[model samples]
Target: MLSLVDSGSGTVVGRAEGEDIVLDVHTSGSGPALVLLHGAEGREANDAFIAALAERFTVIAPSHPGFGLSPRPDWCDSVEDLAYLYLEWLERQDWHDTMLVGLQFGGWVAAEMAVRDCSRLGRLTLVDPVGIKVGGREDRDISDVFAISRSELDARHYADPAAGPGDLSQASRDDVLHIARNEEALALYGWEPYLHNPRLQRWLHRIHVPTLVTWGAQDGVVSPDYGRAYADAIPGARFELVGEAGHRAQIEQPDTLAKLIAEHSA
Candidate 1:
């Protein structure tokens, strides 16, 4: 049985997927399925965004395999591996008409999955996604992107770094391990080409689903040029930018970001 925890203004339905994945899932409202994927430093806390997104669509927010209360398995290595795990998860849930929405690294993984096999996804929504690495644009690098203190990471990953999910003083050992595991996975998949496959970029045109690529005008993590590349790589993809918001524009500017997604998901 799953326990429901109140998030002050709302509730999060929590479920334990054994050692494989024990996560706090947030789902509210009702309609076609929308799966929310989180960035490296967050858990289902990203569900806060998903919950609001649920006002128009049925949301399914799951904590990553090794984040929050979820445990990392030995088999889970590459983003492709994780993507297949997600496919299996959807099958078990018996869900369909799915719109896969992901942020940061999660979004990049979603794109990878769609290009490889998009039989299940109805649409793809990626916000400030990171997959491809550009040449000669070495500002802050993904090689050490997640290799910093919690406070430093929070600042880098959020538009309003002050609104970090919560304080770190209260964080548990589990949380720390979870964070490290995600990096380990990133390192493994990102081995040679650094979390990106050039051929995968070539497959962007093969994605049949209507893809809406959104970015923040102030995204320091990735350049607008990279965003253009992403938009250009995918055939018929619509690209838009949210001003004043950083890498986490989806959370900082939910309504504006949500509007972009709804327009395409419609």
Candidate 2:
């Protein structure tokens, strides 16, 4: 079932970050540099979510090294490596006054980036972010939970049918299969003994930026316990539970998610 909707207008640029090919994405709307990172699903998975955000901010949403159309570099290993390359992108663009929003793995990217440099960042919001393993205290990593048939995709992504699944853009069968195949590769590269790096957790308290952590109330992917721990780990962080949603809270609850972001940025 193909759903018709308005795709964002933008220019895609292939920029070089050392040996890596970085995609320098520019899109509509105007404001500070709001960088968005998609979860393991793929960058395109969050296009509509980002487009809704692009209306109020100069959104700079990039595909991670391998995901989406961007060329994945060999040197990029840990999510920490990803953080460094993204900072390089900012330096290249000479951008400042930024807000960062991340989903799932992308949220980990935001957490990782904040620990590195919070000086340029104004606000941080994470939707079902995966940076550290919550250990049943609060959140559970979806990488540990997504072992089922393809049909389970709907229930896992969104609880509210009205808002539609996170992948509401309804990708072509071939495209959907192609992206799903790559997610396995992502899981292989990113999944570890633990859902996150122990070393990375130590750096969370160092972030002084005003942070907002959100999770789907029904997020079996990464349990709510994990989400609370994430918020508690960070300095001055507030965690919110987006009810009736699961891993893809923003995609399932875009309006609620957007309002939280707007409030945080404001």
Top lDDT: which candidate number?
2
Instruction: Tell me the tens digit of each residue's lDDT in model 2 across 1-266.
Output: 21212123222232444443545354557777788877776766666677778777887777676665554556656687778777766666667768888898889888888899877778889888877765654534554534654446556656753443335257567566546544754675576744476677778998898899999998756778889989999988999999878888877777778778888898
Candidate 1, RMSD to the unseen true structure: 5.7
User: Ten consecutive residues with minimal summed lDDT in candidate 2?
Assistant: 1-10
List, residue by residue over 187-215, the lDDT tens digit for candidate 1: 66566566566567767888788888888
Model 2: residues with Cα > 4 Å off, grouped in runs: 1-20, 24-26, 136-146, 160-171
Q: Give the TM-score of candidate 1.
A: 0.78
Best by TM-score: 2
Over all chains combined, what TM-score does candidate 2 have? 0.83
